[model samples]
Target chain A: MKDKTSKNQVLLKRQDFLKGMVAAPLVIAGLPNSAGAKPSASDAGNNVSYLFDSTKCIGCRSCTSACNQINDAELFSHDRPLDLSERSRTAIRVFLDDTKDKGTFIKRQCMHCLHPACVSACPVKAMRIDEKTGIVYNDPSVCIGCRYCMVACPFDIIQFEWDKKFPKIIKCTMCKETNLKTRGITACVDVCPSGALIFGTRKKLLAEAKKRIKKNPKKYVPKVYGEKDGGGTNILYIAGKDFDELGFPKNLGDESPAVITESIQAIYSWFIAPVVAFFLLFIPVSKNFKKVAGEENEG
Target chain B: MKKSEGSLAQQPLFGKIALAFVLLGLIIFLIRFFIGLGPTTNMSAGFPWGIWIAIDVVVGTAIGTGGFLMAILIYVFNKGSYHPLIRSAVMTSAFGYSIAGLSVIIDLGRWWNFYTLLLPWRWNTHSVLFEVAICILAYTIVLWLEFTPVLHEKGEDSGIMKIGFIKSIVNKLNEKKDGANKLLIVVITLGILLPIMHQSSLGTMMAIAKTKLHPLWHTPFLPILFLISIGFMGYSVVAIEALYSSFYLKRKYEVTMLRNLAPLTAALAVIWIAIRFFSLLSEGKAGLMSSSGTLSTYFWLEIIAVIIGTILMIAVKFSSSPRFIFISALFLIFGASLYRINVYIIGYNPGSNYNYVPSVMETMGTFALISAEFLLYLLFLRVLPILPAEHK
Candidate 1:
């Protein structure tokens, strides 16, 4: 792109330089591999995890009700929230099979991944992740609600308060600021009557999930969901039905999306790349400015 | 500004019509503060960003790329023959970026908290939006300052320098003040550096979206692709602006200048198209172009527009016809603009079942922003020394 801007009326027209400009993308294509140190997802043993077993879940909406009630403490009613929204921290959905014969009850909330994209996507650090618990939370006051987090979330979990005069972003924080602060457990986990939802340290819950899968190989899916999904979610799932049918996003490989973005951004660490580029531009610009000024003086 | 660029006895008759759109925009722009985006925009949680982002901010900044490119040619490369076009291009860049910044403020849900961008602790270096916001903020100031010499010229002509306060400010900022103008190099250099960083980051912003943006638009080379596309877009915008002034203002067209520029503009379009298709093929996503329902139609529509624009430029490479150059550049801009629209809006597949179409107010909002840009630009042209004195 720069070569073509040469002053020679024939400079850009010179086939050799235009060829170089056209092929400039080759330099950029080499960036991803050559840019920076690649950091893999964090593996913290002490991080908290939520285990939701779809096969063990009842049709009752108690967990969803409790989540809404806990988050919205002013409310006395615990009526079931139909879906996850600005106020609803969690919801349970039914994915029915063919012929409407059988349905799997699935719970939905933020994945709170070890490398949550929302935390990375946030321009203002409004989306914050707990170092110990990996609880991804949104600070409403700091958010300049660009909703880039909603765009970046692989699960489409981050919700926006779209209808408000001054909107705020909403998503699951695993009650890190509320129930977990006092009760030492999430509201949904406390209210789940069927043992469908359980809470423990990330490493222990993952071990438990693997043990269950190993003990009941025929009954459970052989894989522990989220063990590698999107570089491992703190919210682990074990379901009998296909994850695609269970309404879980498919093929979120071991790499989190943030890994690529973070690495790319690191190319300009402390704004080194841009500063170098400015110097490169300066050398030519100042030289040319001298000539332009000299000509003006002569005129 | 030492002499006017063929000023009329009064402002052009069409200014009132442009002012009409500006007024409409002002009303809607005011309404956004009182009302919520839910009622005004068709955006839901499913589709968070709509035309305000795709058109106003993304495409809007691209329209200014021509100024950056022109500055590189005239100031950096010593293209004195190209000097006549510099002031107008810089002026366009200033207005384009100021509008984009304004659009961003209106689009934000908590725009007042944007001051957090200045806070070092809140700066997320990993976030592409952070880089984009910082660069745009800096560059908008650079652009206005780059065009400050014209303001100094205009102020002298209009006798506004009679005011002591303004005279002091203008004297300090004036570039024509002999040896003192050496400092102009920094502002000029920054103007080029900022665009390269922010425009590429605009593309990289979507790279993190991964599967959310359809495979056709999402590539590891997004930053590179965006930077190249801006190359063609930059040239075409300058060409179109000049050709437009020639026709309406009845000034002599920079036909020879534009004719010489034609081949480079065509080459850039070709470069962009080549990288785009190569990325599509190498990524094995070319298959999606044909199979992905209406998405395929949009993909072809965008690609075909650039191809046609390329052909038009090649056809007129040797010709001196102003009409042909105008048409070719217009097609090129349309294609380049649609390419951005496709990338930011159409080709972006948040997921199946998540759909968006800009509501009436949202559509008006985008039009209003563009209209406001033009309205202000027309006013500047009338008052300031943007266009150069035409040769006999």
Candidate 2:
């Protein structure tokens, strides 16, 4: 009868320990907003943005040439760059339908997303957002050139310097440090003859995109491409055809990649903290428990 | 009560072949460094990552997970009978992670700036890759510390007193062994925690590439799936290593212990497959299986590999045979490796035009890495007291 009571007591203690181990992590994981909560949309309004009107574009390569002249050396061989490369920060991609009749020229560059996936994916903080200008920038010196940003980018705008022995990621910086500082605007916007590329604050550009769509419902696609796609890109687009038909990524919903990753990571981090604590505590606790059990066996 | 497991392997033929591959791979690596990635690799702007990141770092680390999984069984769960397997498991993990670290440097475009990964101020905590990198680095250190007892044991047995300089170092290490043993519980606990963190983070790294990755592989449940599958792969690797060591080195087969392990792995495999299918169904991505393409083919191949592996493992007839157990392990490793490859390469669609095929040099580099791992494993088994003195 005494042995049975002691055995039950031991079982109860073990169960209590197990319960503590499980509950500790649950409590920690439920901690209020451990990973900083998502930024409100109003907080992103001050960012620098681009307004690209595909209806007005003539497929001319002036912006591409201007971007090359500003960002790259004179060693570029192409007369009209068809795609964004290490030397080409931006390009004009011509998308045609099955019949090849309804052609649309989309100017491609960095989206500078409000919740940029590149910024979230970089192991090192080489890819950062400027607090003052709200422009995403890449620091080549600090970058280990993992190219994870290139993989994470939904717009597929980031390019790599594959030709260089010491490579760096290449993308549009909105002329923040160079042209915007020295010449007051971006080189591509300045050289655009068709008035397709316009640079302004995100709020103003978004309003302009909405106004263009509202004024000409039949002429435009009745939507702003970057307003909610991938949780809102700073670069806004207005096209005549549906954005998906014009080769824009359609599957990326309104949630930011950062939100998706961070939410999961936050929960993991919370749970890991308590689990690690349990393991650390288990060392001493188990030592004492073993001693007691050993005594019991001896007795 | 302790017994010796086995002695050093006598055959040098395997080691010699591995060395030749290593040398050939070194030449190609030099060419890669001097001529640039463009001339040497098939990687382009569209596909920045290739087999190095897919096979070496991602799958390679999963292969290394044997140590932590065994640590959990023997230490955390107090399954002391499995203790003999822990040293070999830790040794293999050390080699695996160290090679993965080396592969990371080789894959980096600016290899010279690799130190930035260690800089605390440079860390991006928001990034999943950051967590993986830090956890892997910490785990490698933990693994080395855990393996130190073998070195101390070797020093004590192999007459380290005859060597003047070596004697002092060994003595110092021996003197600290008691304290290390006391702290070993903590180290073993860390070993368990770190792999769980990093292995899952590896899958989380892909979460950011939602649009680029195929619907078949890119689910929010990736972290959990990766964690469970790696647990399965870890045990499989342990079984394969034990069986190979027994066959090649003329050691006694550890069939009884492995028999217990096979069922656990088979159960985990079922859980992994079920979770995969359930996630696909829940996410409404089951329609992707109907698409007659390379992506679907690779997906089905992964599924079939796991199914076959589980079948081989669960079969009552195969439970006692080391040879069958080894074959089952191979299938598990293959399935896990193919899953990583499919997620990172085959299932990845940056666009319709973008395609990547590893160059001969790139393929040689991967082969070199595996060969190096085998060679090192052999060397450590011979020199260090990694294996038990004999099978109990």
- Best of the candidates, TM-score: 1
* DockQ each: 0.51, 0.34
lDDT of 2 by residue, A121-231 (tens): 898999987765568889988898899998899888899888778778889998887678888788888888989989888889888889988999999988898888887
Give stretches of model 1 more than 4 Å off: A1-27, A30-42, A74-79, A296-299, B1-14, B159-166, B174-180
Candidate 2 regions with alpha-carbon error over 4 angstroms: A1-38, A74-78, A268-299, B1-13, B156-169, B316-319
Top-DockQ candidate index: 1
Scored against the true structure, residue B37 in model 1 reaches a CA lDDT of 80
Question: Could you tell me which residue pairs clash in candidate 2?
Answer: B4-B388, B4-B389, B4-B390, B5-B388, B5-B389, B5-B390
* Fnat per candidate: 0.74, 0.59
Over B1-392, each residue of candidate 1 has an lDDT whose tens digit, in order, gives 12244533135655665667678877876777887888888887667889999999999999988889888787777786777787778878888899999999999998879899889999877788999999999999999878767767676657556778777778776645754465568999999889988998888888777767778888877887788888888888899887665554667788888888888889989999998999899888878989999888888888898899899999996687887888888888888888788878888766666799998888887887887787777667666667777773
Error of 2 at B308 (Å): 1.3
Could you tell me the TM-score of candidate 1?
0.91
Q: Which 10-residue window in model 2 chain B sums to the lowest lDDT?
A: B1-10
Candidate 1, CAPRI quality class derived from DockQ = medium
